[model samples]
Target chain A: MVVEVRLFASFREGRFKEKELELPEGSSLGDLLAQLEIAQKDAKITIVNGSAVSAEHKLSDHDVIAIFPPIAGG
Target chain B: MAGYAGTFLRINLSTGQIDKESLDLELAAKFIGGRGLASYFLTQEVDPDVEPLDPANKLIVATGPLTGSRAPTGGRYMVVTKSPLSGTIASSNSGGFWGAELKRAGYDFIIIEGKSDKPCYIHINDDTVEIRDAGKYWGKLVGETTDLLLEDTGDPKARVLTIGPAGEKLSLLAAIMNDKYRAAGRSGVGAVMGSKNLKAIVARGTGKLKPAREDECKSVVKNALKKIRENDVTSKGLPTYGTSVLVNVINESGIYPTNNFQESYFPTADKTSGETLAEKYLVRNVACFACPIACGRYSKVGEVEGEGPEYETIWSYGASCGVDDLEAIIKANNWCNEYGLDTISAGATIACAMELCQKGLVDPDEIDGPALEFGSGEAIVEWTRKMGESEGFGAKLALGSARLAEQYGAPELSMSVKKLELPAYDVRGIQGHGLQSATSNRGGCHVRGYLIAPEIIGLPEKLDPLSLEGKAVWVKIFQDLTAVIDSLGLCLFTSFALGADDYRDMFNAIAGQDLTTESLLQAGDRIWNLERMFNLNAGVGPEQDKLPRRLLAEPISSGPCKGHVHRLPELLPEYYKERGWDEKGLPTEEKLAQLEIA
Candidate 1:
């Protein structure tokens, strides 16, 4: 299976803005975070496709995951 | 008296009479200060039905109790008047050195009544106030006006507040620019100033402000500084990238309005995100007086240097116009600052025009400049200049989106509420924010409540954005609390790290008043109800408390939040109830009595 990952704000430092990575099916969001070397605590806002989800949520083929640090401005 | 300057200035421009009057302490206690107190005076002094640009209209500039104090982000002020755009009570807020200087000048506020016989500007020193001829500075842009005023005053350190050609020509989209780049940037406040034939206000002061309970105030301020330093949003994100950082986060949520809100998602949004801004054109981070967060961005596009292209500005010029050209957006932002136009209204009006042209309502021969088309960087830039200058076809654009769309026979195309253009968020996906926008006292505004903190950023706690459950209650509380923050002369961003209790402590220590959290919020409630009453009396009643038709009827075409329309129908009634208003959205007599406003 393949998943697209999006990073924003400070979370993108020394990392990619967005990219697709090959992963085994049934990988939990936590497992993907670990694979990307991002801490669970640092992923303050996690979105699967377009809905906010928890790290324990499972990922599937072609799922788009977006992770942001604790950030806000308006 | 401890928190405020104890004195205010009443300048009758029509008679050239400058009167120094004592601030009404009892009224300040009830309304807090700045926005709240100013609105109180406006309602009492001016008729609600008066034409907004008539000599009968009053423009009040006021500072909060905390303004120029030791409090964090305390350099704030409010420009309160009836909005020519929304026909609602307008209290546009801004931060910079000008507000703090006004505090030090021993005046809590200034009320400019009647129209001036000729163009003039006010110059204020500690004990000297004069209205001088501004014949040489009449048609200059904001930046040039500020420079010439400072030179004329012969005080290099004095701060200048002025409107540009947009206001001089009475474009409804004009803004009041201060300290070169800062603005009270909504609701056509500048037009009111221009109608008075007022050119600028220059202030230089050396006085100091002292809190009522010096020791307690110091301790509370210390604690607030610590919390602000620890908060990630304040300490890291905003300081690093400014407010533009929200570009990607909001876009990723799929609620970012695109192309006059005909769409909700823009795939190329990253090109205009904060990350791109920092990497491309950032010159430096700027801070207001006594500010620790420093969310202001100073950027340069080639030879031109200016401030901002903030999150809302980026959305208005970039995604809402379907133009992903970041440099073009920056240039347009510069035009707005120079010409004294509200970027959101100017850009959204252009987007509405683009859609009108696309639908054949706007004839090609009618356009005197560049083609009105989405994704045309040239159109966004040139049209903005034209709007500010009120030139040719740009004159139509200066009327703002609601009027422009209505003139073309498609009022539904204007993405506005109560005639004020909506900001960046496509509220269809964010239910609570939608309710807030629909009922905002000054029309489609986000700062009145800022439900985005809890719904999108998960500040205090995250709530499901799409859920309608308990959203009415959330919107009511947020709106009330926000009124308190605005009145106190503090930036709304402080709410991210602080709570009601924190504000209560600060206010008590400064104002020598013991207000419990409940009582403090009641004051906010009082201010909100007063604004509502003014609007109702002005004929903007319950019927105006509605979202645009598209927001209620059309579901987002495609996005992560596709197939969702703002559930305002379910939220409005609940919100009215929570606000202690009757079914028709009028404040109940008993409720007004409880708030001591009756």
Candidate 2:
């Protein structure tokens, strides 16, 4: 199955903005982070299929994942 | 007030009388300083019922103990007055060297009251304070005015605060530009200044601020620098991307507040994100006095160069209007600074007009000279120019989003609270921020509390952005702490890594007090209630403490936050309970007594 990944802010630096990767049938969000070379601490929040979930949460086929660093502005 | 400059300057513009008074130690101890002290002074000096731009209104330029000291990110000050836009108490803070210079010029604060019959500017060179003729500089833009003032004062190192055509025209979105680009930008403080016929404040101070325990304060400052360096967001992310770093994070969180908040998502958000700006337009990163985190951007877009398009500034002009052009946003941002208008209010007002035009509630021709439609960068720039001049179509736009939306008979479409325009964050994704907006004394402001950090960024602790639980308690905690930080004349960003205890220690070392973190928080509460009371006396009630109807009724139709509305009703009750307020959300007698507000 293929899952789409999106990177924002500093995470996008020296990396791709959007990438699609093929993965195993039941890969957790952590596996995708490891695959993308994104450290767990560096990823503040992981949004999978539009809902924020923990790293242990399983990623389904064709899931859209977004990783962001701790960022806020006003 | 021993740790402070130990004096405040009072200028009665009506009589052209300037008096320097010793800082009241009792008042300083009670209100702390800066925002808190300014609020107390505003309520005492100016009646709430008076017109905001009237001669009777008072503007308090306030500093804090940390100001001008060797404290990290301590070069800050706030202007407090009744808002011309919101008709409520407003406290707008700014950073840069001007605030620190004011402190060093032998003043903890400056009170400007009454009105001047002729254009004037205040010059302070150490103990020398002069209200000089500003007739030549009156009509100039902020940049030129600053340059002329610095030249005329014969102090190249002087820090000048000035307003441009927007403020001179009494436009509701006017901001007071300090140190060229930094501003006490919101709540129309510049309009108040313009009404007084004051154009600039130039300060050139040679005196140094002496902390009570110099060694202890230095130690605290070093520790603060260490904490800031260790924090990824402050040290790396902010310095690298400027404030625009949040562009992608907020958009990804599904709460970017695009297109006058009609949608929570903007497909072209990436086109104007921080990553894109840094790559294409960034000239360099800059910092204010004594600041380690240089989040300020010195950028250019095809020779139109200036300081920012800060996170909210860009978001206000970019996704909020669906204008994906980075150069357009950069131009719009620069225009706002040069002309002295609050970008958030100006852009948000433009977005509101575009929506009104789109809805057929108002015609495009009524806007005068442009399509006034979303996604048009040219329209954004043109209308911004008009708003600055307060001529033709810009006159109505200058009234701000609330009045403009209401003028079209669609008051509910304003996307504001208490008549102040909301910032870039759509409250549908963060209930705590919504609560903050609803209860903000100065209206739909983000800085009063900035509950977004915990909800979206998770500074001290993370909370589910969607959850309505414990938000009231958390909001109160953040709000109180923010008050303390603002009073300290420190950047709110430092709160991301520093704790209340850290602030307490630094303040104690400087102020010659041993107050605990708990007492510091208690002072914040007193300040909060005092501001609320001022608004209450002005006839603002529980009815005013609410999100817009769209926020309460319309769930986000798309994006990650698809099925969410503000849900403020569910949260306000618990928040009131936590605040020790009645069901009406007014501070109770017991609570006020506990905080010694009276």
Candidate 3:
């Protein structure tokens, strides 16, 4: 399965803005995060398919994954 | 020798007497100035049982060592008093020229006491302080009052802090407005000032602040500012969009708190978002004195052109009330600024009444012929004006959400803590925020321990917003850190870019003192406990550290966190344990002894 990932803020500054990620069917969110070239320690990932999702959660096909550097605005 | 004015001006409004007293270094060493110092004064001087609006109440306007310095975002002050709304210690911090001017005027703080026999204003120029008659400006709006004071003082650079009709009427949600728009806008501190018959305070200063080590201080500030500029949020996001960026993000997260929190999110969030405001209404960017980031937005929506609403105010009056009109939000923001009202409390109270009207809990006749329904932008604006002047239906709404709901016999519907209304965040989705709001010293406030840094924004570290584990320790640390920053007159946004080490360096450079992160954090803890002690002595205790039934019992009906409720029970015990407090929420004597407090 393939999923489109979008990055924002500092994450967008690093390299790719959006990418098509090829992953196995029924891959967990952690597996997808590990596949990206981006450092997991640097990026704060949230799956924004209507709601914020955790990394350990499962991802479905076409799930809009939005990743960004840690936000600190009040 | 540096970082402080070394003195404070004491004014007895009743006697029209002004005196200058040397700053107490021992107190400064313990409290570290600003809100901390104000808390010390409030606890030491004001009796716990005295009514907030009574003559016995003291209003302490304080500035910190970092205020007016070159430190990043250090231009802020705190107005501390017993809140008429909550009857607890209320310290509302504001960013503007007033705090910087106060420091330049050769004072670290101004302690005001005793009710005046008539309207008066305090004029402070350098070392000279006087109580002047304010009869001409008594009934004016905050803007008009500030303009008149500036004109009267004949100094265009003079900074003025004043109250409006809302304050004059002793509204529980009245605010002290400065720089025409910036406000210490919560907990009814303005009502306390009005009760003392203080109309305005105009300050003019010609002195310069000298840090103990000018070269080192300048270097520290430069480095901190550079780091702040490098940060994405402080440098780009906030400067470009102000705080309105949170609207879309929180809305997307399904924690926008729409319609008095009955709904988790607003469908029309885009219409009331920061991006829309910046694209549509933004005219220019403004900054407080000595501030580099310029996060303040000046906007023009129709005829209104001034300071636009931040994310909280936009959410409070826009999505929370079910009003999605951007122009209406701008107009309401202007009105609140002019009227010197806390927009969050004002909007929350109105939303509560509107909900009551919808459920037939409140009669339409009582609302003065307007159907107080959700999304009524017209009614919101109209009633805000009324509330500002304490007229018609506005009179009732000025009492604040908890009081308004209690009056209608549906206090459970009010989303508030200690009578002060909640801000933009919905606790059902943000459980740490729920605990923070419930345990905030003032009331339902986000600033006290903004756990959103870790939970929502993922700053420093990522934590699950839905999880209850380890939040107690984080909340305690954040609370202590916030207390230090707030007391030091530094903007909390600086924490996004800089840590306690940077703050300690700045402190050492400015104050000529050797300080460590641990020591500074201890100061924050001391201030926090002192505030809690004040509230505890003021009759607010474990019973008050509770959410409304709506938040505690009713799960969010729809959206991402649908059927989810705040897990306060799961978290409160841990929070208590971390704070060294008893199950009843009382700070134990052992903890006090450890902190060296008698």
Candidate 4:
């Protein structure tokens, strides 16, 4: 299955801001973070299809994912 | 003088008495400086029941130990006064070069008391402090006054803090502007300054700041700067996008307050986002004295050019007003800066009026102005100008949203806390932020306890933004820590890169104290409690610590935050308990005694 993942803030530094990922259908969100070489502790927020979820949650095909480091303004 | 100048400049405008007094070292150690020390003096000197704009009220501008030193983001100062808007303790903070200059002039704080018979300006050149006539500059705009004051003082490098027409008219939302654009912009502090018949303060200094341990301070500053550079949010995102970068991210989160918070999401948000600003009108970036992040934006809109429309201003003039025109938002920002107005209050107030007009509660003809339909950028700009000038429909709008909404028989329509207009974030989605707004010392300000860091952006923690569990615990911590930062005269943005440990090392080196992060935070807790008790004596108690009815009862209608109504009642009790306050939200006698607050 293929999914699109987006990164923001520090996560965008060494890694590409966004990418198309090819993974197994049963892959968990943690599996993708490992592939991106981002430690689970460092990734502050992970949203799948616009809802926050645990990193260990299983992913499905075409599920949009976004990872953001801690960010604040205002 | 190490870290602290330990001098107070007291001026009584009415009696024309000026005195330089010693700053008690014990008091300095207890209260620190900037907001902490200023709040201490305010509670001590100003009578609690005194009218906010009365001559009996005092206005204090203070700098902290880190100010003018090698500390990064040190060009900071704070204005503390009784707010004419909320009738509570007001502490408005700003960043630029003026506070640092004042410190170099050898004073930790300036306490202005009484009112002058005529318009005047305070001129300080090192040791020489004079109250000079300001007839020529009284009515001028902030930019004009700054330029004129520099020429008048014959020191082109002199920095000025001045009020514009809004302040002169005693507008409740008026702001005091410095460095041409930076402002002590919240809680009607400028109105108090205006009430004193004071127009400007010009500062020019030639001196130095001596840290207690110079070598240790230098090394700490270098390490701090390196850490700041290493932080992605501080070094890269902020410098590149400014605060306006939050638009897309916040809008995507479905918590961006739009059109007087009638909606939580706007399809046109991208039109006024940071990404668009950077790609379009951004000219360059600017920084405060000794600042490493340089999050300040320098931009232009057609012929008009100036400093900001940071995220708050963008949300104020753009989403809050139902106008997504970035150019218009920029222009309104320029107008607010030059006119000496608080853009958040002005735009949000006008938005309330716009909503009234939409509901047929206020006829457009009654406003004595054009149609106030949503998305009318022209109306937003024109109404803002009118509010500053105190003309036409702007006259009623100048009273701020709470009063205007009440006059229209719909007080609940105003989105505010303690009569102060809510800023950019619609608290409906961000649970912790909403609670913080309600309990904030100076009404509806976001910076008082910026839970947005954890609530929405997930800074340092990824709590469920919708959860209510353990929020009170974290909010108390954030509030206490923020009080320490504000008192230290360091920009709060540094929290993104540095934590309590970094602050403790720098503070200990400069202030000659062996402080752990725990003790530093205790001072912050003391400061917060002092301000709270001050407000209680001023008649703002737990009742005032509440969100507008619209937020508490009316839930968001669409987007990710849909059907979310603010649930402050469920959290306020816990919050008070966490702060060691009683059920009434007043600090218990034991807590006050424990903190050793007199």
The candidate that wins on TM-score is: 1
- Per-residue alpha-carbon lDDT of model 1 for B1-598, expressed as tens digits? 7899999999999999999999878889889999999999999999999899999999999999999999999999999999999899999999999999999999999999998899999999987999989889999999999988888778899989999999999999999999988989999999999999998999888998999999999999999999999998899889898888888888888999998999998899999988899999999989999999998999999988899989899999999999999999999999999999999899999999999998999889999999999999999999999999999999989989999999999999999999999999999999999999999999999999999998998878999999999999999899999999999999999998899999999999998889999999999999999999999999999999999999999999998989999998899889999999998899999999999887
lDDT for position B318 in model 3: 90
How well does model 1 score by local distance difference test?
Answer: 0.93
Strongest candidate by DockQ: 1
DockQ (Cα-based) per candidate? 0.86, 0.66, 0.32, 0.37
Give a tens-digit lDDT track for model 2, residues B1-598: 5458989999999999999998887779678899999899888878889899999999899998889988898899999999999889989999999999999888999999999999999999999998989999988999999988888778899999998989999998999999999989999999999999999999989987788888898898788889989998888888888888888778878898988998998888888877888899999988999899899999998879989989898888998898999899999888899899999999999999999998999865576767888999998888898899888989999889888888899998888889989998989889888998898888999988888788877777788888888888888988899999999999998987799989998999888888988999988888989999999988887789899898999899898899889888888888888989999898999998898875
Docking class of 2: medium
lDDT of each: 0.93, 0.88, 0.86, 0.88
Which parts of model 2 are misplaced by more than 4 Å?
none
Report the lDDT of model 3 for residue B497. Answer: 84
Candidate 4 C-alpha lDDT tens digits along A1-74: 99989776556666775688899889999999999999887776677765677789899988878786645567
Instruction: Score residue B127 of candidate 1 by CA lDDT.
Output: 76
Q: Considering only N, C-alpha and C atoms within 3 Å, which residue pairs clash in candidate 4?
A: none
| Each prediction's fraction of true contacts recovered | 0.80, 0.57, 0.34, 0.34
| Stretches > 4 Å off in candidate 3 | A1-45, A50-58, A61-72
DockQ of 1: 0.86
Task: Tell me what TM-score chain A of model 1 achieves.
Answer: 0.95
- Single out the weakest 10-residue window by summed lDDT for candidate 3 chain B: B363-372
TM-score: model 3 vs. ground truth: 0.94
